[model samples]
Each structure stands twice: as structure tokens, then as C-alpha cells.
Target: MKFATALLLIISYIAVASAHMAMLWPTPRGGFGTKQYNGRIHAFIGYKDNVWKVRFPCGGYAPGPITKMKAGQTINVRFYASGMRASDIKKQPVLTKSTKQFHQARHGGGMCEFSLSYDGGKTFHLIGRYTNTCPDAYFKWPVKIPSNVPSCTHDKCLFVWSWTANILPQYYMNCADIRLEGSKDGKLPSQSIQIVDFKNRKMNVKELGDGIKHRASTGPTKKEISGNLSGNIPKALKKA
Candidate 1:
């Protein structure tokens, strides 16, 4: 009886630990959950020194299949902020549930950003961002690719999704291997690709200890940069 009870306790702990958001579309570095490993769905959800989570890029996951995309295309990014159901992992694009219950796992709809990396996840360029009420009950969000973004091959390109919770200091990220189909190795000006820390709340780009500045190279004025709310986060998240 004691052995059976201990097994039950272990399973319960894993379920609670793994109850978090997951990237659904563009199919993150690792695919959705499995019967034996449901925690794989939340593999990229990071908190402080969680190693595979906030501390490492792509949650320390290796690259998966490459998705080919165009420079100026609108891609639908999907996420499951709500708790997962058995049916959620059975299909592609992840079917949305109509249930009315609010899952606190949504983290009160936090800020989300879409970025692209050309240097094997060393640096990222912000392409689009959404603040405040993001990733609500609605699971799908559309991200428009900027026209001037450069083309990249499979190994060098990564599409990254980052979120900072409004109710919790927790940070989450997922990366998808992608290749941009276009011509000419045109690079955007330094002002356009701001080098910011989408990593974890504990560390910034400079803290990586690589001596890389944590801001844009050319240093655009504060008025020019958009959707950056680094220091001023919601009070609830701070206290949490």
C-alpha cells in the first residue's frame, strides 16, 4: 500500500509541475505531449534556474524539423495557455476548446513577442510583439513578417516566441527551426534589430558574459523602439 501511495504522489507532483503554457503552432522544437510524457508539452516553460526552461534557449531543446517561410507572409502562431486536454495533442494547429472555464495557467494574458534568429539563437531580432492581454482564451495569434527581414537557411534560422507573465515573474520561450525563402543576404540596419534579453528575468544579454551590449547597436532613441516594457512590469508579477 505504501508503494502504491508513493507512486500516486509522484504522478500528482508531475502533473502540477507540468501544468503550464505550450507553443502549438510552427510546432516547437519538441512536438506535443505523449502518453508517457505529458510534461513534454510544457518543456519550454521556464522559471529561474529550471535549466531546460528560462535558463536556456529553446528550453535547451535541439532543433526539430525546419519550416520554410517567406519574408512577407502572415503566419498564425498558436499557443495553449489553457490547461491541456487529451484531445489537444492529437492534431496539428491544435484544436481550440470552447469551454468557458478560465485557467489561471493563462497567467492573466501576458506580453508576447515574435523574434527571428540568424546566428543560431545567439541573437534575435524582434519582428512583432503584443502587450497586456495576450494569449487569452483565444489560442491563435497572427504574426506578420516584416518585408525587409533577411533570408536564412534551415540551420541558421530560428523562429522564437517569448512571453512574460503579468501575474507571475515567470518567463517562457519556444523556438522553431525555420528557413526564409528569398534572395540577397540583405541585413537590416542595427536600429531595426534590437538586441534585447528575451531570455529570463534573472539575466540580460550582457549577463551572458559575452560582452555583447544589451541594446541595439546603433542605439535608437527611446521613442523609436516599440513594445519594450522591460523595467515596468505589472505589480502583481513583481510580488509573485
Candidate 2:
């Protein structure tokens, strides 16, 4: 009798412990819940009086709030997620093509003016104007491009590009960001592009162009560029 009573007590203790443990559910509405983000998948189970939360390595909470499970409901959570880098937040192509036309104009104080286009061939916008002063002669104005623009869709969408500016005399350069929005149907393609960073240092347009072209390539021709600007820009530009 003592042995049977001890066994019953042990089982009761296990049941109590299991009751305290949180349970995960696949769906919040009925059973446990599931969520996914950044290529990571998570399964959630809820227990009465138990609360759960998950965080991304890049420093952000999952899309939803903590889930609470009622008594007797088991929460199940699943997600196909990956780590997102700070640089990934800014990866998008700089430009689809050399849409800007070269022009010379005069600004106040006899400053030379230049313009370029964010669109492939739609419109031309002013880049900057500079005075002929020796110190000011080599100064380049910084331009921030919009976050969205349209580009041909092959497989995965590409967005964002960045480079440092080279101060030059008589010659001026410009950078732009283009952002694209998708159609309401969720089938139509949209794009966004922009110049996220600009500095007085000389920019390697040729290299930047080549990097974009490589990314633009399909199949075996596709190549990856070094630096966070290229790596994260495309992901940031992707729709949620």
C-alpha cells in the first residue's frame, strides 16, 4: 500500500510540473500559434498563466505580441526565419540605368549647376550648383534618392546602391535613390531605389555600375557585391 501511495504521489508531482510548463500552439485563434520572419520559423505553445516572447538577433520583437493560452490549450509555434544584419536594412540598387543627362547651368554667384534623373529616362532633376571658388570648386552636393523605383522583374527583386562622392573641379557627380511600390493585386511588380550615403571622397561609378549589373544578371551570371550597402539594400527594399 505504501509503494502504491508513493507512486501516486510521484505521478501527481509530474502532473503538476507539466501543468506549470508552457505549451505551444500553432494557431492563436484555436490551438497554439505559429509565426515566421526573416527566414526563421517558430512554434508556440501556451500554458495557463504562462507568457512567451521571441526576439530577433538583429534587435526586434516578432511581429505579434506575447500569446496567452487558456487552461487546457496547448500552444504550438513555428517559423522559418533567419538573422538580419544592420547592413541588410539598406541593400537596394542605386540605379537601373544611366537615366541622367549631362547639362551645365549657372546658379547664384556664377556657380555651375548639374542635374540627373532617378527614373531610367523619365525626368531630370537638379544635382547641385557650385561656385568657382578654389575651396568650393571641388565641393559636391549630397543627394538622397527615394527608397523606391521600378525595375524589370526576373526572379527576386533588387534594390538600393551606395557610394562615396569624389570632389572634383569642373566636373560634378550626382547619386539618387529610387523606391518602388507594388500594385494592389499583389502580383504587379514595383521597385524603390535611392542613394543612402554620399561623401566628399571620389565615387567609383564604374565599379558601382558593374556591381549592380552583376546582381542584375540572371542564372549563373548572378554575382554578389561586397559591403552592407549592396548586401542589405535589396532585402530592405523587399516588401513585407
Candidate 3:
């Protein structure tokens, strides 16, 4: 009887902890969900109670193998479900039919942004943004790699997915290791970003949300945050 009770307690915890949304596509190396995806899968990939770990890709978990693709390709992201209901997960690992739908508010909503990285994680640039609009699950975000992007001189680049919640100060982040081959005569992008931390102010949350509100863009952003970043752009990007 005691062993059964202890097992019950453990399941209750996973249900509460996995409330944040998980990114499904351009498919992060890690993939999504605790046990719902195909092949080998892991637990939810959100910041949740561990909000401070936003800086670490995949919540500080070592990333998965590289996802290979070419330049100017359209990237798509999928989520298990949209905002789910509470009763959805009361059964714990028994996984009621609602487990996939358990990602409701507290499941964290608000904004999502996609970016690209070259030079072995030294610097990254903005590639796409989705604001005030991701549904509970399976959001297909098809973003095309700019025709002017440089090829993987080395073989690949990092694809990053960042989500900020509206109900709390949590930020969810994940990255897919990608091998990108861009056009030979590449033109650099206008704007790029390098997010390294998080804040708690209401203003900060709105600011973070607002930053990604604009439609996907190219070239330096109209709104720039000044920093002394030392990472340099490639010759093709510099000319852009």
C-alpha cells in the first residue's frame, strides 16, 4: 500500500511541472513532450519553475544531433497542443486522453521568436517572429531562410526557438542544431539579437513581447538595443 501511494505522489508532480508549452518544429534536436512524440522523446521542454535557466538551450540539457537543411528553406515548428484544460492531466502518467491537451495557461502563452546562429554559437541573428497568436498546439511556422544567407562554410548553424509567457515571468528556450547551406552570393540580414538574460518587471515582459511583435524582417531592426558585442559578421553579411 505504501509503495502504491509513493508512486501516486511522483506522478502528480510531473503533471504540474509540464504545464508549459513545447516547440515542435524545425524540430529541436530534443523534440517535445514527456512521452507523446514518435521514436525516443523526453519530458516537456519549458522553463516552468526553473525560470532562471532560460539562458541554457533546452533548459541546460545537452542538445540533440544536427538537423540538416539548405538555405532559403522554409522551416516549420509543431507543438503538441494549444492551451489545455486542468482536468486534462489529473490522472498523471496514466495519461488521460487529455495529456497532450494539458498544456493550458500556466502552460505559459504570449510570444515566440526564431533566430539563427553561426560561428559555433558566438553570435546569432533574428530570422522570424510570431506574436499574440500561437494556439495551444501544432503551430506550423514556415520560415524561409533568406536567399542571401551564407552557406554552412563549416556545415551547419543553430536554430533557436524562444517563448515568453503572459501569466508569469518565465521564458522557454530551445535550439536545434542545423547544418545550413545558403546561397553563394549571400546578403547579410539587417537586424539580429543576442538574448542572454531575463527580468521580472511588468514592463520588461511587455518589452520582451513587443520586441517580437513585428512581422518577420530582414536587415538591421528599426528598434535596436545597444550592446558592445564583439562578434563580427561574415564578409557576405558585412556587405549586406
Which order, best to worst by TM-score?
Answer: 1, 3, 2
lDDT of 2 by residue, 26-87 (tens): 11111112232211112111111233222111012222322222211211121101111122
- What is the per-residue lDDT of model 1 for residues 67-168, given as tens digits with 9 covering 90 to 100? 889876777777654343334333423333334332426555556667788877778777666554454424345665566667887586888887665545
Model 3, CA-based lDDT: 0.46
For model 3, what is the error of residue 180's alpha carbon versus the real structure, in angstroms, after optimal superposition?
0.9
Which candidate achieves the best lDDT against the true structure?
1
Better of 1 and 2 by TM-score: 1
C-alpha lDDT (0 to 100) for residue 225 of candidate 2: 15
Compared with the true structure, what per-residue lDDT tens digits does model 3 show for residues 48-115? 35422223445554556677877766665554332322233222222234323343342224556667
Q: All candidates' TM-scores?
A: 0.64, 0.15, 0.58
lDDT of each: 0.53, 0.21, 0.46
Backbone clashes under 3 angstroms, per model: 1, 79, 15
* Candidate 3 TM-score, true structure as reference: 0.58
For lDDT, candidate 1 versus 3, the one ahead is 1
* C-alpha lDDT of candidate 2 relative to the true structure: 0.21
